[model samples]
Target: MPAGTFTMGDSSGDKNRADGETPRHEVAISAFEIDATTVTNDAFARFVEETGYVTEAESFGFSAVFHLALAAPEADVMGPASGTPWWAGVKGADWRHPGGRDSDLDGRGDHPVVHVSWNDAVAYCEWAGRRLPTEAEWEYAARGGIDGAKYPWGDQEVDEGGWRANIFQGEFPRHNTCEDGFLTTAPVRSFAPNGYGLWQMVGNVWEWCEDWFHPSTYRRGTTAEKRTLVTDPAGPESGQSRVMRGGSYLCHLSYCNRYRNSARSQNTPDSSMGNGGFRTVALRVESQA
Candidate 1:
């Protein structure tokens, strides 16, 4: 995006204040180039082939999968994750086998590659000579230059005119109506692109950001003052978990309505799951004689 300044954080009154998406602030970002869509399985496969890199999930022998998307048999299923019974730690649930051992990329090569941890994303970035967008950069790009809008497409409810994003349509975690034509993940380019020509920025999967997450990150430092324009705020210097944005297919209005421009979430760097993925960005290098 071109170098510009915009207000960041939740402006909508209906924000999950606990997620620290509040205390709206002004942020100035420099010019940078970002992927139009999250990394697809086909793109990730090429990275794996080129580097022979094994993802964290592949090394861990298992990864988190939504219970409803589990394709593994009873033998491969490892039961639900603690506190979140909707997720199960299933064996062989890596990017290649998103559902479990029984699943494969197959015709879903164009879909965002899930089960990729923040660390895995970083590895891929290194191999590709790119980097994950900072939390601020991600949000700014996601906004698509719409300024203060709840979503990338200017605050019209996601399903208002039709299915704008691939999110839960029915009672979440129980019965997915698939009213949006997707139960888990739709193609990376399923929805209309934002004004910036970026697709699926608010749904399909949670994209990892290159920033440590802290509930009070915004309220802790100089960014706390709305008058101060935080220039390219990276995030907390140190934290246990990294930031994740854009929500995912499981997001629902009745349950997790985080499919907005300012919604935020986090996970350990090494944690991988079926609803997680990432995109990359590159700094603009001017030509020189």
Candidate 2:
């Protein structure tokens, strides 16, 4: 948790579909530390090599494959295979083989690793002598001191000055010219950092946080709700899905603009997909309380 103060949530724009990003407010956070970027295959390889740890994706023997990245023996490839036809359950798609046994992370050592679950992320954090950030901490870091700003850089559009982060730049799931220089996952250092020196915090991958999912808590009987103004406020005690942040490259205005800083989404602990992955954060071994 790097020390900083800024408004969280959407402060200036109505340019979003996510209702949870409304009522941007000021928030003060303590000084802690976080990952400079999302974890990569190389990084995770180090953990696994040293600890012999196996990820859930590895143990389960399957990872979700995007419809476009799947091989159809004669079928309609539309969206992600997890919930859509485009996604196909591929076997042996762990860190070693991101696309099952056929694909590999050859030149993708620097790319943000995908196919991880909430459980996998937690295990990595523990092995690295760190802990995942609470939802509040994750949001604070993602804000990058922009406060109520719509993005880590600002309210400026992605094309006004060209895309600053890695996100879908073309039409929906149909065509992606890699206009932003990357089609799937850009090089981890492909973009600039936010106000707090955090890179790729807004896009690249949706990171898992140490919190549960809860939508009703954000609603305040029309006045003001305390839970909405979360301050290191860990979400619900139990939930079917865990908290995830920092939208992924799959996000697009035509589909999901979850790439925004204020934007958030979630998935079950057991679920894994091309767009669903996580990054780990640390609070300093001494800050553990």
Q: What TM-score goes with each of the models?
A: 0.97, 0.87
lDDT of 1: 0.91
Model 2 is weakest, by summed lDDT over 10 consecutive residues, at 71-80
Best candidate per lDDT, number?
A: 1
In model 2, state the lDDT of residue 184. Answer: 73
- Candidate 1 wrongly placed segments (more than 4 Å): 287-289
Best candidate according to TM-score? 1
User: Where does candidate 2 stray beyond 4 Å?
Assistant: 1-4, 12-19, 23-26, 71-83, 220-223, 226-230, 285-289
What tens digits encode model 2's per-residue C-alpha lDDT throughout 70-139? 5333332233454455467776666676655666788999887788888888888888888888777887
Prediction 2 global C-alpha lDDT:
0.71
